[model samples]
Target: MRQIGLVIKTEGNRAWVKMQKGASCGEEHCPLSSSLIDDSQDDFYTVCAINSVGAKSGDQVMVEVEDLFLLRTAFMIYILPILAGILSYALLNYFLKIPSLTYTGTFLSVGIIAILLKRADRKLNFPYRIVELGTASVCISCPLKNRNEQQKLKP
Candidate 1:
């Protein structure tokens, strides 16, 4: 379902929007679901979609949610790479005892792996992307979705 909402809060890599769909003046408080993070206030909770619409406080937004479980897993996928890199790097030396590889090598390897993952990540078709203010240079793929509908997103 697609929703038109307003951004209520911004927190560590996530923005919480109080979906207009669930808002009612007489309701006193609006209940919201966050795709990434929940940072809501007394009357409203924040949404956690990407800053694609350039959605600011009080700005209306159109959002599409797939599935609740899917949303949770999507977030996991985005975080797994960094976790893997950190875990592997730490284990490679302290536990694996492949001491021949220097710390520089570990860092370099992590960087290279991250770069490669990011390059591959560009092909995904996620629900959101930060819409560029002017130039299209800083647009990044939504790490939360598939690859075909990518261009259909804001960035």
Candidate 2:
């Protein structure tokens, strides 16, 4: 999977890339979507990736990650909660034989699993690389591009 991001900063071998929230970017499971990963409250999120392309700050870079990795992440994020709920309901119903208790257990299990996943996601670094720099996706509307144009126009 490949996505475009702006290199916000660089530290040694890793580059912190600011990613836009692409609601329709297919099945690519963005690990940074978890609030535990970023403390900042904003529409965008930042992620750390290996600086294979030696990209500098403000560069529009194409990041690459394995398809299988994304698939596993998606499953863990989307499917695990449902599975926990089903398992909780089954266990609770069998042991207690109460309908309301079973439903409550199911909901509680799902919420607990979700919270765990969110916390774990903070440390889950899906391996990614900065494959290409200055890709065609960097258009005039891009922040770095507009900054360059504005500087050129001044003085």
Candidate 3:
């Protein structure tokens, strides 16, 4: 999915982008809505992404993040642990024949796996990439443009 953002900071080949609030495809039921990070205070969210488009600080750019990556990460972080706990509980109960030991084993295994995944995430890089540098013409067609125009018309 694509998002329009301002390059708030740049470091080497990466940029800290403050995401603008609006759907890239201008669809109310966009699939990316669930994955897109949002902030409540300023209607903007920040993310560090690869600067493949050579965007500089203060420049508006389009960033792309794979939907598959988001779904995979979510599955691993949320679903995998629950599955692991269930499997561990079943196995322990069958082998040890003790309900208490089964619960303990399940919890301990889930904790260890969660901690290891957290460490692994720190060592891995995100799947986001900068796709293009925004132009004045791009802003004219942006979804936020209509909102801005409506606000101006209000007063």
Candidate 4:
């Protein structure tokens, strides 16, 4: 999915981008809604994105994050633990013949798996990339357009 962000600052090969609020995807259960709302609240929260496109501070750019990556992340976070738990329970119950230890084994396996995954995630690179950099469009109802116009009139 594509989102617009303003380059707020630059350091070396990275640009800190302040993401702008955009129209929802119309999904009834959008997982990104909470993050999007929080990001829109203030420029305090910014993403340090790769500046491969040569985006400079004050530039408006389009950031593209793959939907496939998002889906995979969601599946890893939500489904992997349940699968691990079930497998642990089955192995403990059938192979070890310990029916009483099934729940304990399941919970322990899930916790261990989650901790390992969390650690692995820290080493993984983000799947999103900067696709383009361009001017912010002006429209009659665009709030950013008004802000830009005001900035232009200031000096």
Candidate 5:
């Protein structure tokens, strides 16, 4: 998937971007509109992406997520549990002749797989890269000066 974001910080060829929400995602009803990153404290979420085009802070750019990675993630989330349950039932009921315990085994296997996948989630960081740069000069809240201004306004 592709997204438009502002480069909030750049270091060692990686850019920390704040992705735009709503129509900027090119979807009328985007599912990721409310998704937040690790350090999101405002309207937009931050992501560290590969700086393919050498984008700098305040530069608006386009970032693309790997489609294959998305497909693999979907399969793991949607299909793996079903497969585990079916295998559990087949082995427990058909091979072991324990009809009474088939459903229990299936449930247990699925639960175990879910726990494993949840733990695996931490290691999955799909690559996002800058594909194109936009002409926008700066973001609505940027240049570090705006952050300082907001701090002074607090009572």
Candidate 6:
């Protein structure tokens, strides 16, 4: 969805865009939210926003989200550790009949699961969209590159 709004607020790397109904005619209206993706953050390296629309404060700009699922998956990685810990404890106690080793096994399983899941998510793609606040343009895009392209670019 396109926001076609102005920069109502900006703190650090995030910006909130004010949405307009039809066109921006200098009137107060609903506002939408957007964030500037910084390449310094590895996760957002391939999702950098192309600022060709000349975005500025009070200047209607557009923002886009390329991969929504991938974004959600990133968050899931955080929860996996907790789930793994509990599952480990339960499995050891119930299946293996090893109650005494539950706690240690639980923590170890959590660490392992978290690391593995994080790596997996990095290699997958999430549902994404681009929000052009200024032009009120939104495009669903993917951060994943084609296997052939990757092979060609690799050293």
- Best first by TM-score, ranked: 2, 5, 3, 4, 6, 1
TM-score top scorer: 2
Query: Tens-digit lDDT track for model 6 on 123-148?
Result: 86432222444331332321112225
TM-score to true structure, per model: 0.33, 0.72, 0.66, 0.66, 0.69, 0.41
lDDT of 2 by residue, 1-155 (tens): 66667788899989988765542253226555544565665546667899988999988787778999989998999899988988999899999999998888889899999999989998898897888785555443433343354322110
Q: Which candidate, 3 or 4, has the higher lDDT?
A: 3
lDDT of model 1 at residue 93?
74
Error of 3 at 21 (Å): 9.5
Give the TM-score comparing model 6 with the true structure, all chains together: 0.41
Q: Write the per-residue lDDT of candidate 5 for residues 1-155, one digit (tens) a residue.
A: 66667788899889998864543444325555544532343445577899989998987777889888878998998899999998899889887787777888889999999999989998888799988884434333322323454432111
The lDDT per prediction is: 0.49, 0.74, 0.74, 0.67, 0.73, 0.46
lDDT of 3: 0.74
Ranking the candidates on lDDT from highest down gives 3, 2, 5, 4, 1, 6
**Model 2 bad stretches (over 4 Å):** 23-41, 137-155
lDDT of 5 at 8: 87
Residues 28-106 of candidate 1 have per-residue lDDT tens digits of: 2433333223444233333467776555555445555566644664455566556766776787778657666646557
In model 1, which regions exceed 4 Å deviation? Answer: 1-61, 67-78, 94-102, 127-155
Where in model 3 is the C-alpha error above 4 Å?
A: 20-46, 135-155
Candidate 5 deviant stretches above 4 angstroms: 20-44, 135-155
The true-versus-predicted C-alpha distance at residue 52 of model 2, in Å, is 1.1
